[model samples]
Target: MKVGTKEAAELLRICTQRVRQLLKEGRIKGAEKGDRFWEIPLFDGKPEVKEGRRGPKPNWKKRVSKAISRICVNQHLIRSNSKHGTNKPVIRVESRGIIRYFHSLEINGSCKVVYRPDKPLSCGAKLWLEVASDVMLTAFVYS
Candidate 1:
């Protein structure tokens, strides 16, 4: 016997819209359009959904309008790999802080005496860092 989409949906545990979609996509066999609606064959197994990807879409990719040309600056940010890029302009005046850069990545340098960031830094196109002046001056100054 043939059944309406609503009955088919209830029997198959799906919505009537899904049943219509399956009929439109030809996924549900033994179903044909009647005078006013689709007639799905009764006692037939549940309709099988098409196999495809089932997950949230991936994030959009960034497209560059121009070539990646490196822009040179007098100083470089130490944590340039941060999400917010390099030296973004900021207005923080009247604050006591020491502007220093990391020097050699020596073996003993990582040996740890507790307080780091007390090492002497090299100037030029190297990394630039900023630390509180009071803590920096009181911190251990490594050779």
Candidate 2:
């Protein structure tokens, strides 16, 4: 079965002008039969809607590798002494690992330190490291 421009529009629940626009954009496969007529071929005995283009897929392996590299290089160990608190020191790290781009660090134990990065990191950026205590260690990394 086939459908004219108007019929196709009605069947597709779109306006007649939209049908013409789709034809102009080469979205829907159809051909002009005359000055004001068009023929849309049927697929599986029915008119089929055109599919849209999809964006590129993400590179998971590259992201994982970059995260591992950041961790292995000890990029999260950078820090400075706190000016306001004489006993406590401020810690910082480039974003990376399970925490990509920007992330908050929470260390539980002796120091009980909480650290937030100065800037957000990229999809596979390095992370800053901060420690709160000297006993057992618990770290939380979020993407």
Candidate 3:
């Protein structure tokens, strides 16, 4: 029996989206277009997935990143240093139908709170960044 693209992807040990790409490129054998979907013929072995740039690759060796964030109602260019244990930004990707961006300030090992009249540590607000989509930055958020 023929299967849909999603089922074919499962049998092939690949993603459904990639299966669709393969279908578009005419790479899948015994693949036919149905009224509602593409009917793919399932075989005994795994199908060959296309080789291309699936996504962006980030450089992990570099750690120092710069970001413009609003702290205490003022915008300052924040330079994040991974060497520092405290005040490092942590990004979390939520597992769901759509990818979610969640950011928080983290302090590891030791933390010290200093009170100053001119500048505060908490900043009395959440961190907001201003940067381009192509740029990558690890912001040091102060909470």
Candidate 4:
């Protein structure tokens, strides 16, 4: 006997839209589309969904646009693999608590650290950083 999509969806334990999609994909044999409804054969039983990828594809390829400057916070020196220049304006700053960079701002005190600012800090180039920090920081820089 031929049944409508609603009845076929109920017998297949799926939604009516899924049944319609199966009919459109020609997975449900002997199913014909009428003016606005689908006529599915009752003997076709439940069709098995093809086992394949489910979600969106991942992004595996990485493109680097900026030259990375590695900084050893413990050593207080910056290193770069790019041969463009030895004194590039890019500096990799890593702080345990907070890290802040200013163009012409210098902080000096009797504490254990003193910062002296230089002119012409960065050119028209942009800076991009990727950082990983944990909760409950205690103000300590790691190499």
How many backbone collisions does model 4 have? 0
The better candidate by lDDT, 1 or 3, is: 3
Kindly list the per-residue Cα lDDT of model 3 for residues 1-143, writing each as its tens digit.
Answer: 46788756655556789789879988777788978799876443333333445554322212322212221222221234334544433442211122222244332222223335554334333433333221223434445
List model 1 lDDT by residue over 1-143, tens digit each.
56778856755656889778778877666788978888777532333334425554322112212211111123334345255565442211112122322222222111212222464233232223232211111122233
Cα deviation of 39, candidate 4, in Å: 0.6
Ranking by TM-score: 3, 1, 2, 4
What TM-score goes with each of the models? 0.32, 0.32, 0.32, 0.31
When 1 and 4 are scored with TM-score, the better candidate is 1
Steric clash pairs (candidate 4)? none
lDDT of 4 by residue, 33-115 (tens): 78987776644233333332556432211221222221222112234424433433334343433344322222221112223
Comparison by lDDT, 2 against 3, better one? 3
Model 3, residue pairs in steric clash: none
Indicate the residue-level lDDT of 24 in model 2. Answer: 76
Candidate with better TM-score, 2 vs 3:
3
lDDT minimum window of 10 residues, candidate 3: 64-73
For residues 22-74, write the lDDT of model 2, one tens digit per residue: 67767675554666677887543334555546644322212211111122122
